[model samples]
Target: MLFSLIAFLGLIAGLLYLATGARPLKWWRPDTLVAHDLRTLPYMLSYPFEAPDSRQNIIFDSASAAASSPSSTTPAPATQNSAGAAAAAAGGVATPPNTPPSASRAGSHAQLVSTPSSASIGTELPGIRAASLDKLVQRLTHHSISDANFAANFLMTYRAFSTPAELLEKLIHRYHVPLTPSSGRGAATYDKDFVHPIQVRVCNVVKLWVKTGYRDFVNNPTLIARLKYFVALMRRTGHEALADAVIKSFDKQAAKFAADEAAAARLAAGQVVSPASGPSSPASSQPGTPRPGTPVAGLPASAPSTPAHGSLATAVAASPAAPTSATSSPAILKTPVSRAMNAHIPSRSPSKEEIIASPIPMMPPSDLVADITSFLNKKQGSATDRMSRYTAMLCSDSLDALEIARQITLVDYELFRAVEPVECLEQAWSKKDKLTRAPNVLAFIKRFNDLSLLVVSCIVLTPDIKARALVLRKFMLIAQALRELQNFNSLVSIVAAMNSSPIHRLRKTMELVPEKVRQQFKAIEDLVGASSNYKQYRTRLHNLDPPCIPYIGVYLSDLTFIEDGNSSKVEGLTNFDKYRRVASVVREIMQYQDTRYNLVAIPAVIKLFSPDVSDELGINEDKAYENSLLCEPRAAS
Candidate 1:
């Protein structure tokens, strides 16, 4: 193709030389040729979604206004198509041969869809062969779906400091209040959450008979059953007000749990090294010590503004205890970075070995098992004092190291399940120890995570203190529910009491993200990188689904509160990354016409972009309105 184009240009050059006396193909300079090709290339477009009735598609393209009168030539309803000509004609308007394609575009950090494909499942998606993944999305978002406020009890873990997996065990023993089942409607009628789609429900029955129960089918044909159990792991961070299954004694239960853990850590301190003698080898252990547990009493109350609070101080303290055996790193934490992550773990609860090896393995790793041992071996103060001292010694500003260290540590408690003994972090729950923990220890650990998150949240969202504070209150509750996850079972509903906290609303979207994206784009990254350009886009999402950045939402909410009087030049947004994301979501709204904002609510499908987006999109305002450039579309998305 390139050779032919060059030859054609050469022929044109020869003709010019013969007729007009042009000496050479100067127009064919590499830069000129490249520029010419770019200018002449055809525009690209796509249509990622098509409504059930072509009329709906017409409405999006402004056919109602274009046609003027719907009653004059109103034709019978017709099937929907990407072109949507029938819809236009039905309203007495001639269909423009080319309709602007509502195409899906590429997403940030596009990752593989983990669900089993239809071919792998041996057949098409049952009950909802409706081309769009929207058909199978669960619809637990009815008016009755509300979050119950459970944020105040346990700050980090729902069962923090509890010996038994109280949360999981509850799921095992309890019966979830029944949800409204699928209404035997078409694929156009559902959503994706606790509520099951009609198709999925039917497929589950078939899967039981063919794949698990009867084992009679030749090849497994039910995709629903193959849908990983991970789908069931839904969270609601936007609503801190709604508590689905309210616990009666949450605060009391949590306080008791905290007390027990504090005592145990105190005992560990006493047993490891007595205060009179100090640590066995303090000089050898803390190689680069930074004022272990010493007070900076003269400083003001607001002095400890480090990007991260506890982890680094621990890392500095644990320098001598770096785990030696390679196996100390979980088999699941296969990445070298994940292995190196253990170097700066800050606060892990109770303490256990195999506990960290579960679902999300290797969170908030400290220097290593060896590092943790050494830190503990030479430590002489209470855990909170150690943490407070560490907080004081940190650099006065946020940094990459602080954020990475914080996230890695959080990954352990919030996600990873440690397989090996991590006495510094994990704790094997015994009925006995659950009763003896110090309440203050639980508060310190929980606060450590919360404060770290707050710093990062400031980076991701509004720097306003009030908003960050409100969001934080809600996030703390979500962490409480998670604390009880070890006892999680199929029988219990994992709904957090839906609080009004907007952060609670977006939890589902944030939680199940692939481990890699989660690690990189955490609270701190979001605080710093969620620039002004991304706010409106994110706000649209928060209104739609609050948990978009649940963890960061807490901190941003807090920052909003504190900086009500601050004056900063808030930059405006022009990039389409956030808008593009919102566009895809609008399509999802279109899928189920019965949503809070039905398709009819969209008066005009305006492709909003600042003047800046226009340049990148390669078109002017007039042309851009009637066109959207898209190169790819996802069948699942």
Candidate 2:
């Protein structure tokens, strides 16, 4: 037993010796040498002493070793003879005369990292025993790679790998794989020789993702983002389609996310889960439709027909009977992922039209309120700016009308900033003939007009643009808002139309208030409504003529005459008698170029009556017709 104990102790000691470098058993250590080398083996090995961090200590070792032993490797000592030669020959390295050469820099480190070249196989390791290979390996750095994987792999590589070509050539031999040489152009192709086996593996990955889980994906954008970079790599270095495949794989992932969410949501909602609809409906079949025999869920295209309508659902419903021939298990399914994943997936969200019609923050307080007012009040001297003032007054909230207002002012300020209205020519061009740019100009005008109406009614109502223009910028709110009193239906419409009409804002202002208001107080409701309607009456309206009310005029604002309801005036109201008289004068003196479009009375008559065409007209037609004729454009009082 004592002898056996000694023998056991001896074996243990031997194993311990093997474990640690009990003796310097190896001729050369690849790893230690590699480490020692990188520390000093950088490319610019021998730089000037003045150079920062010069590797002189590592580089001059060769010369020192030579001095120590005159019989050192290079007996001729030619390498040491050339001192400054390193700058030109070694690309700017300068070894001192007494320092040791870098062992690692001499290519030993590289061999340690990778396989030794064919030239090294016959060469002996400095002192390693072939019998000790196993023991040395135990002490040497254990391969990070598992013995089970790629342990025997013969790497294909070159000592001085200058370009991708050399790398490819080596890889072909090492992997025993064939590859087609690229043409001079270097564009990648999918020829038999060129297709990377790894790429095939990537394709296989894609196939696996699709075969088992196609419908589970909803938003594939993430997947797209991921595979996209790889695919791009392929495009630049490999085949376009392979890159495309990577991109498509991403698309699939994104789609999967979306589908999963949608399906989960439906499942949660107790609704039916179905295969993805095609592109048109997201539920519609996809374009480049797969043939009837195309495989899905690992079922061969020729497999027994499962009804197309519900095959996937049926298979998923029965997890047990589902085929298991796929390369991998279904990716870990989560409860439906967050909605964010559907961002790239098209079908999961609401349609644009639906979104538009839905209530939204489409309206906001008008920021132009003060701006337009300032522009309006700044008017030096011009009636032509009336439209500018008008639009500014009307639509502080409306982008379209304000835009129109902006254009008119911009044109005016740019061309005739200091010029008065009359200085500019009238009836400047042919009717129905727009200047080359006028159509675009007019279209913008129309857009602003349209936007104005919608914006105002938006009930995100702000004060009128004209009032803002006048108040904020000293711009005239052109004219006051068209009254809602009499013919409110056309009031707003008229304002918009007048701006767009051939009549300049200043010229148009003259026609806005009928004489019935200027000389006398009359309810404006009798003739015009809103400025918008006023415009409509001029352009689109018909069958609307002066009513047979004997009232003198229509007063749109305050300070008009009270109706016959009482002898005394009521608070918040006025009378129309004075307008009746002005209506007579206006009827006799003025005539609109287009008589069909003119209002019966002047703007002055607007202050008296409200527009509802109230029962203020006395129960006497003769009196009413007389006044009506007085207000009429073609008739005399």
Candidate 3:
């Protein structure tokens, strides 16, 4: 019985050692071990597995303590997790969350005990931890539905964060990581099903990178060579279709790059460059002659090839030769009608003689104001009459707010889309010389300011309180319509105008506004309110799909913040972080620029909102306040 008990105890001990992977007692081990035995033995001692939540709390507490300490008052650097630290040691930045350890090192001997489940990978994306470069790349190649969108954004903005060489290196390293189990001890082994998917995804990511950001490769020969190397590997591995796609994209982008360079050269040489037909033919480049298709100043590209109605030249020629006055120089027209007509002219580069000629007589400010007012009245009659005409022209049912909103959207869209990417570079729109430096951006901003002023003027200039209240209500409905149409630019302008001092001070008029309208206006105010740095507006903007006209001021402010917050370079290398932030914002702007509103343009409405007409109608804040006082004078103290 004693012998049987001893044998049973030995059997139990052996089973326990096998089940738990426990080491034998020190006394049981041989004094000298073979090479195979040493290789099989784990190098590091294993510890009890701790829950991720417990580990996370510990890290957070340490970080919080460090942050709150008075002795270390300066802002702490980005906290690097263990995996990130490991990656940093290997000549890279932090490893992104959910990335495998094998890819983090080039020839690392460290082993992964277990692979994370597929479901757990990429589930924590877009979080702070995932902002790391490696995380971004991992997410870009992820199989999640949102990965495509994330990839596009990263592609658009990656230049700010990383260079082509660094990114390509990471991508190649990730692709070459061993997916199959290794015969060597302690080597990682992923599921066979998961392995194929990851490899395929890496290839897909490369294809997408080529398709979306081909410009990077076009501008850099080194990148193209590296890409070819990757492609050669892909071909060797039997990924012929994917390899073919990559090669084809490279060829296509290379051709496009060559064509673009040629076109730019032609443009620099004072030759016409057609968008559709490439560089203009030699026959079209007659010296000193502008191309017929060339866009005229202050006119949209879609404007009629013929001269505008009542063009300055026609008006000047048709006017009965007015008797010359000592006060009126030949260059200066006397009649307000003629002056207003001449103001609509498309300005062009002045000829040598015109530039050197005697200056035109300047109109006194009072006379200028009088002329503008008279011109506006003659063109559209009184404010009330103009409102009626606009309402009639824009709305089929006279008060069809949706149609009014659509018309405003169409006009705003035209101005918004006309702004070029170059106009916003370096905060050109905000500079003192913005008129020349950023003509398109300045024009867009000017329209916004004018629209805001116009809204305030319409309310305060109304003689009757009831009519003013009705106008206010109409604007409120238009704001709501703008919101629905995703025309946040115009929506904010109208909202701001309604909340301006002149309009807001009208207690009686505001009292007449319906509760529904007031509530709607309140909601709009909440949406666009400056509180919390316009967080609500930004959130709404993010949730919106394409074909949106985002408030330009928000993006401009973002660019400004990026420019002010970060240095342009670090250690003589370009500061890609700043570039990344700027590119992210600019990418959004470019995306919106490409998406157009579906609403049809109305010629009458378009003319009404034209820059010239808008300037004439856009009263100054002081004038608006004066009108407000006239409509409803303050009670004597």
Candidate 4:
């Protein structure tokens, strides 16, 4: 029995060893000498001292080993003596008998060392493991988009057989799967064509790579080199779609980088980077689009001819072979607003009919408070009936909803226009100063909060699980629509309402929410979450075509951060640079005031969202939890 137990333990140990060395074993199979040589290194170390006699020498005979080594097995590059021979051949001079090769002062040595070929540069470094890197490269064309994206991102993320640039170069030049366009040189039929298995796979791989990895490529010099280098190669190899995708991605990052660098340089040099240098929104573009490089009205081109280091100039300079058009003069791309967030202005001016503004009346805090109380008192319906009315409000026409959003933005711009950024920063100005200077700003924030509170109350008060679920679900849908409409003002309020403590704490009601509805809510919640400083929201905001509402909270918070973190002056001089950056954001928000889309009447939604006596419910955290437990008691195990 003891013998049998010992045998079982020995088997387990052997299995563990095999499991750990599985890949190594595969790499160092019987036919492979590579791993065998690597593994033999510790045992192959030379003695520190020379052998006492020639016969006792430990080192193997070079001639015998060379002759015995299999001809089919390639020698490592490091073992080659080509460099010495090449240097001697180039100079046509043999080394002097007394002179050691290292001691020789030949110009050929300098010439050979100074410039390195791509292959030599790559091979000289300890690069990624071929087995793993090749595996990853193979997976780049995986059937699943997520798998393909994962492989592409991972390839650039980890350092392996070569630097990222060299590895990417290998992927493009040595291992790239070619994508065939259905028609040569014509519009790409690949988008519509379903045939060509390998071509389709390659196209999808490239598309996902560019879409997912563009940000990394833009930020990383090595990846940038890889992107630019591979793009040209792909284009030459007749993969137009892949090449175009790279160009499109690079163009966006490059343009933004160039504009920012120009602005930063101007600021550092104590020159006012003109607002015109900021990217112009298409919404603000005049009847005739301004020509590239021309200064916008009311702003002058202040950027110096010479760009400083770490700027887009350096990025562009690194890739001189890239097209001149691809790296257009930085001045042309400059505008006060982010190019990504540039609102899509109507190609033709807004027709007179589309120019209606929201009909929601802007009232003072006291008036709004009274109006809300009056509306609540006059409310005449059961919770179910109220939900029916709420559904109708949620189902408001998309255009009308957009108009409401526009109106809200209009009011937002008007109220906050006079509130300087400094007032929002702690220690910069007192709370009294903020209120005195911009009472409207305070009123706007209060009204939105009140509306949010009211919505939460309405949902929490509705006792029926299905009715509450319906109301919550409808609100989620409306919020989504508001996001699509780019009316972030309303969207923010709706989201805040749904996520309020009372509504969020309703365990039983929440359980009644459909799985799809819950997923949709989670998605929207992620968008507005504080993660990455609301990066998802900003991305979505930028992606939407203009005629959208700017989320006021984001911009306000931005100003607050800028004001608190930075001083108003540097070296006793007014820091116009800080002011300029702040002004650009403010100007962009103000620009929305001119939007032509106006809100049509949706009285039910307006009333539903308006503050009510429910605001006095005082639903604290403890109360919410208590109410939640009452509705859905935890099951005893």
Candidate 5:
């Protein structure tokens, strides 16, 4: 009787395990249930034993902390696609209380579902499936960035390290707290200093996975889903630059994979897989036959032995047949047919590496000077003609005007890159360091002053009220576009012109300005205003996509503040921190320096508005007074 009782108890335990429908235990049995049923079975088995406080089942106790942070809490509803019962049993994880069910669960499952649920357990056991990769990603929302970083690094050694879907989702879906450092003397000044380290580390890891695990990521449904999620998140969060990089990397990998497969298929089919070559030169003819350039034995003495460099081959290539426009050298004309053939063979587009490696072509000081001279010399057109052309360029699309502004900024960047912080103290240009930075710095000042003059001229010279209003509207548009382009220097210059005493004193003229235009101008003024160290502008720039041009003055101010606040040397030892701090600011400018701006030159537009006069101050108080007097009706004599 005792032996029978023990055997019956063991049989009962086996029945309970089978009822749970665990996948590992059921491997040898013929599977009768679908995946959905299998997932549901475990929940059914646990239902009787589940306690009332099921919310405690989550892998992490984030719910309570999430509830406390009212400002940052935005819990996503639990997804129906989660492993259901098995997931719930794995951890006490439940969807947050009071959240609505996901819209996706609104079909047949909607009828079956009775209660609202919280988010599913993002954590999964190692070696389970792609779901296991999410274990590290789920940690990103942890209170400590270091903890998240540690989890990410430790997970790299796991057999199921990272899935593209899991990585991408983490990048886009994870909770993030904005970095808002205080401006106190003892506190860090930069938002980056306080940013979650997980953001940086995870980015590096994703890039690595994409590079090394290309096959796993390419054409995978899971990765595609992640890519879509990433795009949506970028739009919502305004962190578009990060999303742009990920998408670009994905495209590159896909294209390379396609190319490799095509090559492999050709090779298997016994077709030539070598890169296509251009037509062979005439000189490559068979040795026995009269080679190209070798006179045939039967030819007359007058007949040429070889094709002349400027013969049909060359003339055909120089289609216009104009020597003045074309190069005359024999070397240039050599193998014209081959050169022409190769020209038609379109070259592959430059890869991202090549683009980043290539430097921005520098414009010489002489060329810029010439452009300025031409702008000043040609004052022949009526004010209307000049203003109309300038306004058209300002409103032009595809960032042509903004590109010119950035080119000017590039000049400043190059000249100041090597400038020492100490040189800023020298009022007089006596030191070599000061001289090195002076030209570009001085040119920048001149350029700024010149823009102000142009602004004043536009406002003062337009005699008609309606035309002046139109001119102001264009200037307003230009300012708005500059803000969008992140060209702070030009943005401030435009705003300064509008606020110039001369322009501001036009009380009647200001009234003529449309209310919409005036309101827009005020908004721009507020953005560039010196409140909170230009916090509004900085926030806007952080969200903007690159190939952006920054306002250099802000960076210069940072350098000044750093120098003034900290001593360069402490106790006769070199203060590396001060140097490092200054270098960081400089590096920020450099990152934005050489980005290629896709802009087409509108010479007519550029030449018309190019900086002409380099005078220090163009807002002549007296000239402003004269304009004010002119605008006001004369007192009755």
Candidate 6:
């Protein structure tokens, strides 16, 4: 029995060893040499007198290995070699005799590291270190998935670290790296066989840069010229496809810029630009029909049709109205007796004919409050009937969280896209005259706050614990859907509402929430959390494609930092850097605006979002807190 027990224990140990891949034993007796193993193995093989400091010895050994294998790899260019020598000197490492200065400059001592060895070109780096310009270019032009991802990120955010001119220069230098074969080798064979792949990758990188970040070239004439020259060089070298793609992207951006300029010119001239009246609009399709909002000769001037809501009409309306001069009014109305008569006249609601006949200025709805005034509105029926309907739609098990999220995103996206880049550039949304300067931005903010309050109201107003939990779960699911939809604007709003004091303090209600939901909520919280300055949220946002609505607050904060931290002039020169940085942020905001969602708008779901109904739902922060107390009273002190 004792032998059997021992045997059983030994078998269990053997299984664990296999399960762990025998890692513990391998630590003491490694099957292969690794970086850490090198620290001791060299000393172990050397005589006592020859022993050297492990770290420095490792550097020395690398230098020696590189020096001995000169023909095994391509030699770095003269510029790189000099930079590596400078880096080695700066690091206090002595260059070895009989070794080329570049050879003595190991990867650890980098002024600028040479091109990576062929084996390392497409492989993942073991760890991140400061790479030289040449190394960065190599990585940017490498043919590997990991390298492609790195290239995308670098191109997207490179403005923050390097100037466009500097990057362009590096790319040109990489393109010109000598491809001449060694003596006695056929130049044609070397050019055709060896140099072709390198040239292809360089051209591909340039094409990607132009395709994804053409704005960089568009905003700078010098860069544009440089890019054109590069394209010409590429064509001369036989990369016609990539060269053509670069030129096509630039031309596309130019056309878009021209269209924007035309739109701005029309706006400035007081012309109403309809959103639906694009190049392919029905009005354009039939040239005979006058566009909506345009005055037809036969129609009375006051009878010009009103454009759709949330259109550029809002922007036009927000502009300061022209003051009515006393001379412009009738003499009788200007007189004191006439004014007295006007004061005595009782005010009345405008009739439909009167409202239609009145010259309505293009603008946002003047009323700040939603149409849904109260629960007791006569049109909505008796209070009990209203409650039943609300419960049926919101609290019923038939609620489609994803559909709800999509509808919200649809509305939110319209508001988001309406924001013009100039509004952000001028910081108009934060100004006291925001109504006049950034009406669309203000509208978006209003929607965001209203959504947050509505979320709170829904959860706290439910009288039953189970129903409240159900509402909470529904919202959590909606938040998940929002995240999936890449609508961070609404996602952050809902998460903020869920985290509000009123909803968060419901201990019993929260306890009833399922564990899976709780975990999901936790993840959502982490994603939108303010920790590390919203690092996780920013990372996730950068990874997302367009048809997304990012939280404007992040961009606003970035603008604030740029405005406050940098001076407009540095040493009497225009601080172009500050403006460049601001433009970069604005471009990112505009980038997402160009892509509209493909989701079909449901009339019923949209009706629920009607401003009137939303207001009637009583989406007030104070009311939410009161409802929370009524649902679950405070604990005894």
Local accuracy by lDDT, each model: 0.23, 0.24, 0.50, 0.40, 0.40, 0.51
- Runs of candidate 2 with Cα error greater than 4 angstroms are 1-197, 200-390, 397-637
Model 5, range 1-637, lDDT digits (tens) per residue? 9999999767754754554333123223212122113323333333221122122221121222122111111222222233322322121222212222212421101101101122212322111111112333433332222232123222222222333454554454332322222123222322233223333434434444453345444335566555444343332333334444445555565554455444333322322111222113121111111001111122122312232111212222222211121111111000001011111111134343333221232222444435444444565576456554444333334334344553343332323322222223322123464434344444444456667677776676566776666667767767776765556776788888888777776777778777987888899999877677777766665544444556656766765665566554443333323333344454345444333333222222333444332232134657655765675654689
Model 1, range 12-76, lDDT digits (tens) per residue?
Answer: 54654543223332345332232223222111011111113223221222322232111111111
Model 6 root-mean-square deviation: 27.8
Task: Choose the strongest candidate by lDDT.
Answer: 6
Model 3 residue 577 CA deviation (Å) reads 1.5
Q: Write the per-residue lDDT of candidate 3 for residues 351-444, one digit (tens) a residue.
A: 3332222112222244433433454447756756765544333222333566556656655664575565445556767789777556767666
- The true-versus-predicted C-alpha distance at residue 321 of model 5, in Å, is 54
Tens-place lDDT digits, model 6, residues 393-491: 654444467777766775676567656555665466788976766666777887787778767877777788888888888888988989888899989
- The CA lDDT at 46 in model 2 is 21
Any runs in candidate 1 off by more than 4 Å, and if so which?
1-533, 536-637
- Give the per-residue lDDT of model 4 (tens digit) for 149-232: 133224323331234464454454322222222124221332222112222344444444454333334336666655554554
Q: What is the TM-score (0 to 1) of candidate 6?
A: 0.45
Candidate 3 ranges with C-alpha deviation above 4 Å: 1-399, 417-424, 432-439, 591-596
Q: Which ranges in model 4 have alpha carbons more than 4 Å from their true place?
A: 1-430, 612-626, 633-637
TM-score of each: 0.20, 0.16, 0.47, 0.38, 0.38, 0.45
- Model 3 residue 610 CA deviation in Å: 3.1
Off by over 4 Å in 5: 1-433, 613-621, 633-637
Judged by TM-score relative to the true structure, which candidate is superior, 1 or 2?
A: 1
Clashing pairs in 5: 57-92, 57-93, 58-92, 58-93, 95-118, 95-119, 96-118
Candidate 5: residue 428 lDDT (0-100) = 17
Looking at model 5, residue 604 earns an lDDT score of 27
Instruction: Pick the winner on lDDT between candidates 5 and 6.
Output: 6
